[model samples]
Target chain A: MAEIAATASKRDVGRGRGLVAAIAWRSLWRNRRRTWLTAGGIAFGVSLVVFSMAFQAGSYGDMIYNATSFLTGQVQIQRADYIELSRFEQTIGDATETLRRVEQQAGVLSATARVEAFALVSVDERSFGAQVLGVDVERERQVVNFFDRLSRGRVMAGPDETVIGSGLARNLNADLGDEIVVLGSAKRGGVAAMVLDIVGIFDSGISELDRSLLFVPIAAVQNEFGLGDEVHTIVVRTQVDDSRAVVEALGHQLPEGLSVRNWDEVLPEIRQGIDVDRLGGMFMYAIVLMIITFSIVNTFTMTVFERLREFSMLKAVGMRPGKIVLMVQIEALLLWAIGVGIAMGLMVPLLAWLQSSGIYLGEAIVELAKQYYITDRIYPALGPASLLAAPAVMLAATQIAAFASSLRIYWLRAAAGVRAAE
Target chain B: MSSDIVVSCKGVSRTYQEESVPVHALRGVDFEFARGEFVSIAGPSGSGKSTLLNVIGGLDRPDAGTITVDGVELNGLNETELSDLRLHKMGFVFQSYNLIPVLSALENVEFIMQLQGVGPAERAERAMSMLDSLDIVDLADRRPGDMSGGQQQRVAIARSIVTNPVLLLADEPSANLDSATTEDLLQLLRRLNEERGVSILTATHDPIVMSYAQRQVNLRDGAIVEDSAAKVA
Candidate 1:
């Protein structure tokens, strides 16, 4: 023993890792029912968290796509002050050149130039203030598809033709083919006027746009308004999920006065709506995870307290307190791994099924869904963010609870502990 | 300070607080236990025999004075150093047998040697040899929960002496055993003492245990009252 002791003093003590790990592994099964129940609870919580995150991501994606597809076009480029001031004088000078430059950027599916001016429309007895959007008819087709929702006639086919919203058409008590005169102030403070034949009336499902917006060919508006080869904004449709990427890609390349805006910036209420809904969902997930964490803490506390005598015996037999604490931590990690593994096994396929076979909300919400540019079918999207969030939280929380509960061993006196057991 | 003395304690005093009132478990115990000697500390309940055993084994510290085990002072050593000293040089046999429940008998016996960084093959051979000496090699793979009290105590004894410590401390080793089993246990300790010359110090109230010892020290209250060896001299 003295010879062995002398040799041991040279080598590292507490190095018998295999038996310690084995001891830890076997100890977890001492209460098989409790272990399984706790692991099952973790699995249930993780599955719920991952599944709900997938659904949220899927729904948010759909909402953003729907809202941006028709009006915002995912990304837009305009004069630095144009979005805030909406000044007719603040316009991009080379509309065709700007459109060409924006279309050339990567991830840009399509780009269209438009001129916007606030005007008064009059047809005989009725007159109301409206926002007239001057758009390049052919290129606009590739950017926005509101024209597909036209209720009467067709999209503007000539320089003097226009498409008015359904609400505006109803307000003016006007029909397709009726001519209306638009009057506005152009750049240089001159009177800009035009008589456009109402060729189409569209119900965009958005009341704000339907009540106050109109569209006409860019050339006629430019010709009458005396705005030579200039447009207010260039809208770009992107294939990417986030419009900010395209905006960043186009940031340095654009002319100095031009500023790029993502769909969120263009339509802040949609972003705000998604953010508020996401916060509420996160709060719910946090509550679920916190509950699971508390249960884990309780489980570990009971385990350590009940095993104090056994731990004291180990210590008396020459086991370091750190080794014993390490064993408990290993048990926690194993539990976490088992729970998360089962959760992944169950959730991956479940999410795949939900992703492919979307949940249909039925016709009751079709109209209401349409108002927010959402559809009846919502597909749950499984991405990296949703895949990893729950398991990471469980792992971190489990280790913390285990370490906290296992700390009592460090303060336990070996002889007192053994005697207390007696 | 002589090399022949396995344990030395001088003016050792330990006090415990039970509900804020001080209980003097040990008051100024001074003694030297020689190598290869089988000694028993005999006392009634709360007579401080167990406390003296604990202090000498380094399982508990003396609040005043000093304890030196095999020339290493217990007063100056840190917790880890004390643990190492216990692991390498001292062995403990409890009345309850205190074998780790999760470990098989063989693993429990090999546990201390493993902590000493012995190779796996040597640890297994030595553990089996020790169990064989105790006539319990057949119970090697059996867990403590699957064994009777006598069999468990034999395994605990095998674990304690497997690493061949300088001193073995038994605190009421026969307290939970029947008469027949106690005879077998005492014979085994005597045989180990005769054959291998291992020093042992046991604290117990049992007359049978005290009868098996070569020398007996009797205590009352918190101090030693009689020494059989001194009386014999």
Candidate 2:
């Protein structure tokens, strides 16, 4: 029969999705080079964003870990006034008991108590002022990462043995096995003096640290300073990256005069640095996505403009303008999917490799990075946020471009369009 | 508003703005076509033949006057309503065949039914049956670019009439076809009109297309100068 009748079945059965999508998909390949170029632009932009996001995440995590591990640990419990004043008289009185309590808290990986005092170190005729930290040897090894910078000799195993910074050793003209005399004011107005054997020398790479920091046994400091078991701070190593939670949990259990501080509070410089760098990265990414969006807008505008007659013909045969617009949007969706798919195909394996094996910064760059406590190697992170953020933004951008370009269909008069083709 | 009249246009006037000058495409035209009748509007370029078809098909609105298609007034209908009315009641065949280039012949035929939410199995069946009737069933999977102009026009006709519209409007349908292909297309239209009881209104200046019509109305400068039906009656 020449005539075909309309069926009275369900009005919303299929909505011609397959046919419309097929048309939209096939229409992209009509100009193969333009399609490739547009898709390539999307791929390049998305890949750059995704890769950089991963790298930023990985490097920032490494920086935070290193910064905390060096001396601050992930969380710290200190006498309330000690963090600001750093005086020998203001100290945590029952520090050993407080350390034990903090180590019992969930997410507290390890804890060590230390006594910090400013003293004069004299080896024969040479004498210089230095900041000496008296720590529990085994526990300090577990909590602090400064031992990783040890250049000579072993960590102190005797009460009177100490490790001095290389710069301090140079100033005092002291060598390993030399006995150095430490003298400082006592907590109660008497003389605090000690003679310690220098067992190790470390170069921490920071000029300030190398010039004046030293570590001795906590017993020796408590005996000489007349403070029997008092400590200035208890450094905590948290089990996970969420140190604030650990710090909060530890805060409620600590003694009345002690306070717990997370890495962000103890090291605000790192947080501020990350925030500023992230802002800059976001601005750069926005510019990249905006340029890509402009290219997409141009692409769809030309696609729709060139097929004016086809769209008008569609309208003439009873297709709504909304449906025509939807078709164009579907084309945009297909294009984005192609670009994202290609990116994922190439990026997943590469990011996996980078995550497994980090890229090493050379010796010169490592020395420069060490001042900020960053490690020698950097890894690209492979996480859901890094994977999804860029593609999601691109998807939204492309859809907006498609919708903007397709608005011209609303102004299309089917009669004029068809007549113009004639 | 007669039940037998498929379309009615009264005192229709249309004007176009060409740059800074005004051109009257149609001036105070009155015309009507009965159900199941084959009629042709014959005129030269700029004589308003396509303009009359466009206005009657509800693709364009008249600047003055009223048009009623299949008993519904086109005067106040919104774009969406006009689209719905056209989808269910009217079909159009353009001079250039204007088939969606991405779609195959059968897909083009089934597309209208698809838009109407017809079942896939049934629309495909009907599309294939329609193509077979047009004697081009073998070209069903071929795209328009691969088919001859005659074959493409046949597919276009299949697409337009597949939804069983009450009125089929053809604008210069034979303008791109050779003499032999034009004759074949006219015969196909004649068969579809007689067998399916569809009302057809074609706007053309071709003598062959006019000769196949039951009634011919000639236009000059946007006004109807002669009506064969009025003379016959």
Candidate 3:
């Protein structure tokens, strides 16, 4: 009995491997064009998914960075009442103490205080409404790199000097060393106005900021507006490794009249924009996947119909219906693997090149993006998750499509079919 | 010697449904083939010869009656068991030569051994030996499409015999071949039966095929009309 069992097992192993090899090789080589076409369909679908996902991811990353570093810091700490109402009556008095405490917290990389107000700036006859920012130049530069992005002149050099955005400069017909007048209502119901020389013009690649941002020394803006010893907000930069933890900690420790917001929440609209972009990407991917599914199904069905006589011959030779089903499945899987593999091989380098070179949306799309999403540039960034996820999704989709097309072969009765054909 | 019955069929019937009508392809066919016998099932087109072949080969199930091959009842076995019976004990050569176009002659011959669970080394050895026996060893690596009709038919025969099956069923094996190739194939079949003691049951309408057989079972419509043995004495 033991000898019989051993012999049976040996035969099984030998036959199993041989059968698998013969079936896989023959099935792959038999209908070369059909197999390749199915594979190409899967690869095309996967490549579209991978490239689009990578591009969308990169663009989102760029959008957030261009919006935040170019304007808002990673985290913003402000008076609770100031956030809710922005009333001139409520402000953070002695923000230096809070700034010192925030800087000491773990992951808190840098901290600076700023006061912001709506005002109008005029250069010669041209005037535009602007958000005037009162900043500690050294700390602001550390957080935002505003000095390096200056397109024309230097950043604020002293208390009376200011830096206007490039778009604002273009609109106002102003340049470095030009005098601009700032006009607005002060905190105490008194009209406030000041004359400052533009020290530089900076472009943050964000159209909104470029058109309406004016940076001045924090002390000068405070004195000119008659807001004594009060800072409107404290901008903090947290270490990348501990940004979320630091934000949560700061949210707890901040005083009642103050509120803290991470970069994500500070720009809810940007997050919403990203979500919309992701949905658009999903819609496009679904369309492409559907097209690929149809192509694969069509090819497989045609192959099956064309090879009916061959299948009949296999059945006549005593191959089980189940083995026939398995053979068809293996063929489908091979085609899918080949197609997706080729597509991925082609797309990886293509997407990497795109990541480095970026897809130029042309001037019209750039302007449209600026007007719609408040940014001028679109950069593709693929995260690790997006890169890995796109391929998995595509493979799963192809498998389902292939399986659906294999049903006819699986249920085929060799005996009946062959007799009928004969 | 009577104990060596390769196939025994009793009251076997097959009905194929077409559109909404039933076409009886075989009716109460009682047949038997002995071990080492080269038998031919002769019938005109639309007769029951192919149907009888299919039923005996376990490629089709009879609507009624029983078929026993090597004393194993084919009707009682399930689909898998029947498939195993075909894979292990019986080999089939088709009228069309039905060799897989993608596979080379050697691979086509190796396929039955593959189905029978033969290892790569053994399958290669047996397939090459079979092709050599049929005098087509040089064409072993050529695909069916790359070979002539006679060569393809010879490869098909080699594939049928590669697994060392007890019964080799050939359905019009020489239908597509020229007269010379047909004579060559008949000689090969005669040699296999005479030397190897392999039981063969072939279905054909050709008188040439009938002349080579030791026994002929003639079918008309759906029933056997005559069963006659050639006088070898």
Candidate with best DockQ? 2
- Give the per-residue lDDT of model 2 (tens digit) for A251-343: 787767788898988999999998998899999999998899899999999999999989988888878788889999999999999999988
Q: Interface RMSD computed for candidate 1 is what?
A: 2.7
User: What's the TM-score of each model vs. the native?
Assistant: 0.94, 0.94, 0.78
Whole-model lDDT values for every prediction: 0.88, 0.89, 0.79
Residue pair clashes in candidate 2: none
Candidate 1 positional error at A310, Å: 0.5
Q: Which tens-of-lDDT digit does each residue in A47-113 have in candidate 1?
A: 9999999999999999999888887799989999887897888889978887888888888999988
DockQ winner between candidates 2 and 3: 2
Write down the TM-score for model 1: 0.94
lDDT of 2 at B225: 96
Native-referenced Cα lDDT, model 3: 0.79
Number of backbone-clashing residue pairs for each candidate, in the order shown: 0, 0, 5
Question: What's the candidate order when arranged by decreasing DockQ?
Answer: 2, 1, 3
**Residue A16 CA displacement from its true place in model 3, Å:** 5.1
Q: List the residue pairs that clash in candidate 1.
A: none
Candidate 2, DockQ to 2 decimals? 0.56
Docking class of 1: acceptable
**Candidate 2 segments exceeding 4 Å error:** A1-14, A255-257
